[model samples]
Target: MADIDFGDAPAWVAVVLAGGAFVISLLARRDSKKSAGAAVEAVTEARRASDAGVRSAVAAEESLALQRQEAAARQATEAEAARPRASLALHWQGGQIFHLVNEGTAPAENLQLLTVSDDAEPLEPFTRLGVGEVAEFLIMTSLASGAPTALEFAWDGQEDPVRLRVPRSG
Candidate 1:
């Protein structure tokens, strides 16, 4: 018969280390759930903003002629669809400045500047407005990347976002 023994660390020491690792895993699990919840909220906000955008698009026909009288009627319909429905106008005041007018019957919330290119990039920092309010923002050229683009107003997924312009800087 032959006997063999390996010594240096006790069995109980290894067992305690394993137990500590298990406890840490349980703590981390809770933190992961919190992060997941935040992600879900962000997705919900984006969906709401997207829904408002779709309705706005439908109001403007694919005919692509804003010069027609019908264009005014379509614009009115889109504006009416806004939350608290407000009239909005987007104009380039030059030198990276833009004018946003909210002349509608309803207050617009989370009114942010969004630039649409081959990819989505946020233009000016987010701004909010009430009915009959006008605000000006400096457009960041970061939004002008990729291609000729449309810069518009969005509600940060909270209200209606409007498509306002095709920039001349293309």
Candidate 2:
């Protein structure tokens, strides 16, 4: 074997080297834990930002949907409140009350009924009735609020009248 020179290193050199190695290992472990913590925090922050964006987008869509519904409801109310002139009548019999008939060559379809001034209303619901089908409406004595209860039944291009009393129980 070739001779190995110690280069003035003493027997204690092994202990010094072991001590240095232990100190270096502790420092490396601490640095690694810090780096891992930083990585986790970064991921958490990114997730929170993504969630916030999604929530904002959902809120905007909901607001728009509500606005659309409100506009549609307002438009329907205006149309129903202002129709052309037509009226119907109220007839009573037994405990069962029904409507008078409104028929013509060009009568309307499922009538859009409304309260007339006190002397007119349609009194039937006709299916696909062309030019002479009858329309019916009900007027119970108990359901009348206006002094003179009147009804107006209107359809595609036709209108009629009937006077109905207010219903009481039903």
Candidate 3:
């Protein structure tokens, strides 16, 4: 190689170049730190969004459960309203006089009283018994047997007979 001298200008140029390189390195390092911080912020934001999504799903499930429970309760109430009910009670007014009272919401049609013993006479059937109405009948039971312990009765729209216990006479 042939030695060539550039009269002290080469030394100054080398020093300037080295300073530029140092400044460039510092800027690069600053930009790298900013990028790392941005990456960490993005990860944190993603985690928060995931937690929110899980909470929303749980809330939706709870709302659906409440709706189902309300629907079931409404169906149960409707079924109870559709069922037929009979409320007939026997009341003893005096010695042989007894009254059958209709205390239900619906009317009792073709009301018939059944006799459990052979000695008792069958009472006349009622065509229709309205709500809050009463039907009087005479029960000719022997003094030894008193009144029938229980009286079985049937009415229209009822599939089974309802047995009512008779209160003993004083």
> Relative to the true structure, how large is the alpha-carbon lDDT of every model?
0.67, 0.57, 0.85
Per-model TM-score versus the true fold: 0.37, 0.36, 0.57
On lDDT, the candidate that comes out on top is 3
Candidate 1 wrongly placed segments (more than 4 Å): 1-84, 118-120, 123-127, 140-148, 156-160, 166-170
- What's the lDDT for residue 26 in model 3? 100
Model 2: worst 10 consecutive residues (lDDT sum)? 85-94
lDDT of 3 by residue, 19-65 (tens): 99999999999999999999999999999999999999999999999
Best by TM-score: 3
Native-to-model Cα distance after best TM-score fit, residue 2 in candidate 2, in Å: 15
lDDT of 1: 0.67
| Structure candidate 3, residue pairs in collision | none
- Pairs with steric clashes in candidate 1: 84-106, 86-104, 87-104
Which ranges of candidate 2 are over 4 A from the true structure?
Answer: 1-29, 82-161, 164-170
**Model 1 RMSD to the real structure?**
31.1
- The candidate with the higher lDDT, 2 or 3, is 3
User: Which tens-of-lDDT digit does each residue in 53-135 have in candidate 1?
Assistant: 88778666644565575879978888757546656777677777777877777767666666465455666554467877778
- Candidate 3, residue 94: lDDT: 89
